[model samples]
Target: MSIPGQIAAALSLWIDSVANTVSARLERARGAQQIAISEDEEGALTLRLVSKASKDADLPPVRIGIVDGAISTPLSPEWSAAMKGAIVDLALRPSRFVFRPLELPGRAVEFLDGIIRAQIDRLTPWSPAEAVFHWTPPQPIADDHVELTVVATARAAVTSLSQALLDLGATAVDISTATPGMERIAVHHQRIGGQTGSSRLRFALIAVLAIAGVPAILSIGLGGIVTDSYDAEQQQIQRRIAERRAIARGSQGGPGGSAIELLARRKQTMPSAVMVLEELSGILPDHTYATELRIEGDKLQITGLTHDAPSLIEILERSPHFASAGFFAPTTRAANESGERFHIETRIKPQFGSGT
Candidate 1:
């Protein structure tokens, strides 16, 4: 197999192992009843509820005979009902399984399962795939070595027994064997309800992920297209602006230059009102008072009452900010007025720097 395929298989096996462990813990926490089924030399089966409580010990065992892979006597209704949602521990006669002892360095203990599987064919009459097998806990021996016994039986026999118990409504089945003087060794286990539920849940999760992925992929593609479209539009607008600016620069000597250049030239030649007001405030006499002032383009107008109206024109004409200073209207005084009323207009110089 390819590396990716091998990795995927490994990951799947790990997930299955973790899920089974969690399920087993949850079942134990719920205190599921244990049922023990033992097979005799004649292939007859004995079933009894294994419980710690004293009251359960008085219940009689149910016996059933097996012939040609089928039960000859069916279980009673009460016994059948008790089988549902129970953990069935089935102990087969030792003669049905082959026992082999294996010794390995103590460091190899963690990898014992893989080592036994690889060497199963050399130790037994059947291949690993054709046999259901398990090893007892390792015992430390001399020379830093550990020894254990591998108990194995034909897969067909164990499968037949487990299927029968499942058919009788057992939630899970554990297959084991005990030698004349050795402790019981568990060979295989099956969780009927858990397997079916896990398969359904895995299918549902895959379906949900597939459904959600379609919209996510489409949204990413559509977002890229929209961004490209906006970028193209922006580029086109920038190119048009550049073309317009080039045409304006080329038409500078025509009827009128660009509007921006025209506005800039006007600003340079215009007289600022603030500068004009500042110059006038210093130029005017202390006795003179101005009531109204106006500045338009390069021209300034001042109207006020003063003790000396003629002297105002002389003062303005001498300043660098005023080019031509004169009165646009006649100077007149009213009967109740204490001073002469004068109107003066001036053509301001474009020398904004000297004023500053």
Candidate 2:
């Protein structure tokens, strides 16, 4: 390979290695975790180190020790040692950091690191050297644009913190701002030597992979259309054959009209879907969202996600249009932090013209 080609390949391999390392570490950390949660409380910085045990695979975090301004008692030595390879989260008050949002062309996002580094001074109240800034992962918006939340804080504000952490021994350090009712925003982090380079290389690799996958995506899309058309044609032919067979059989067999009328009458006795939906919209909590709703005759099956699923049943049972509101399965946490997935069934109350 040429020198540049070999360099690209090396960068690619390094990027993959770093990603795999971080992913594996995170996976293990989630199972058997120890996080040093640092907070600035009443002008005093405290680090609370905790470990979680997976009891029946549902782990609860146990308090390890509290470090009041970088000092710990009893288990200080244990915590110091543990801090060597542990991920340290330094929490600060919202007033300490300046949060600013920046919108940039999505096309220029590939060079975001460079762009941010260059414009950090202009974007923040401090000089580039004095300010420690970190931009949140770009969120894509309309018109091929992206929005970024840049949190910048003065380095001097946490100078004592840097010495204390390094003295105790910490592998990776992340500084985050904690606000009421909002998720902690990681503003700055200590970078390992290869990580910064790896990030750039990772994006490059993604672009290359996407370009390579374009042809495959196109082929698959075209193939799907052809397959769908063929399937539809086969289905139509099968339906015609079935109808012909039914007609031939109908001449010899008894009429199925009575059975059909009985189904129609049963359908007529069912409750109104619109009334059921209106009741649900009025009674259910704002946080709840239904993913799957199925109505068969008078039986209604609802599968959805919510912050509180148990409360949903009570709300449903209270509604005039619903009865027998209960969960069919256990609720589990959703993929995103949205809430828990719930499966519940209820009986719909029949309305005057609901059956029709």
Candidate 3:
């Protein structure tokens, strides 16, 4: 079989899963079958306890077993206390610690991290890299895999919660800063096969019909306006064609520049240049004067001089109408009438002719 076929075959047996977190106590039991199972229970469930620590030496050991589900005994007292202590320690830190049902703890951890980071940035200035997160596995499964659980809290929060737990006669130990764990089971359900191709064809046909109906529905509702809009567009296109042909007729020889030149000449003949010059004159400062003005396409480059080059660049940068303006190193001249003439140049965008 091909690699993809092998993967697909494997996927067929693999069950999709979601991360789950259970904040519970572990009980030390002698026998493996310590869980209390009820006759009324219909399904299977696995229970696990995870301990988060600041250091390896401070962590407490937890044991788990299967027993009758009807017996309502807390899993592990020593481990449960340790887990509670972790929660208390997490709560005391500057980090906001939330003990949520581990149903979707992976997503919960992600959202909590963002919330804590934003809160920390607002409350105190700190770098996220300097922050450390220490986590311990629930139980080591050989050397390669271990069951781990994590609680995300800020350093400040840990300190606060630790002190509070201490007053309550609980010895809160520091563990890892950030700990995350996942408990996922590959649940198998009876695979019932169904027709796949027919469903795909039906979905495609429904999508096509839905898309085709939009233009038809719009045209029907705006029938009169649609006719007027089509007529206007046709007229505009015909007018442009006529103008292009006339320009092409004139540009028969001598290296043609029909499309761009015609447009440029039309723009140059327009009365907007005088208005733009007037606006520029009003905005120009006392000492600055335009020595040369060049207009290319819709760009206007003005070569001018100001006594202070840096101040001129600052003024241009602050202007709302101009997007970006840079000053070139000014060329200094001998003491002319204007006392050491320094030439500077700047560029600005010119309002373009409306393109159809």
**Model 1 lDDT per residue over 97-192, tens place:** 998877665656866665676678878899989999988898997756577888898998888888888888988888889955569988888788
Tell me the lDDT of model 1 at 100.
Answer: 82
Candidate 1 local accuracy as lDDT?
0.76
lDDT of each: 0.76, 0.63, 0.38
Q: Using TM-score as the measure, which candidate wins? A: 1
Better model by TM-score: candidate 2 vs candidate 3? 2
Please give the distance, in angstroms, between residue 78's alpha carbon in candidate 2 and its true position after superposition: 5.7
Ranked by TM-score, top first: 1, 2, 3
Model 2, span 244-280: residue lDDT tens: 5445555555687545544444444456777777777
Worst 10 residues of 1 by lDDT: 260-269
Which candidate number would show the highest lDDT if scored against the true structure? Answer: 1
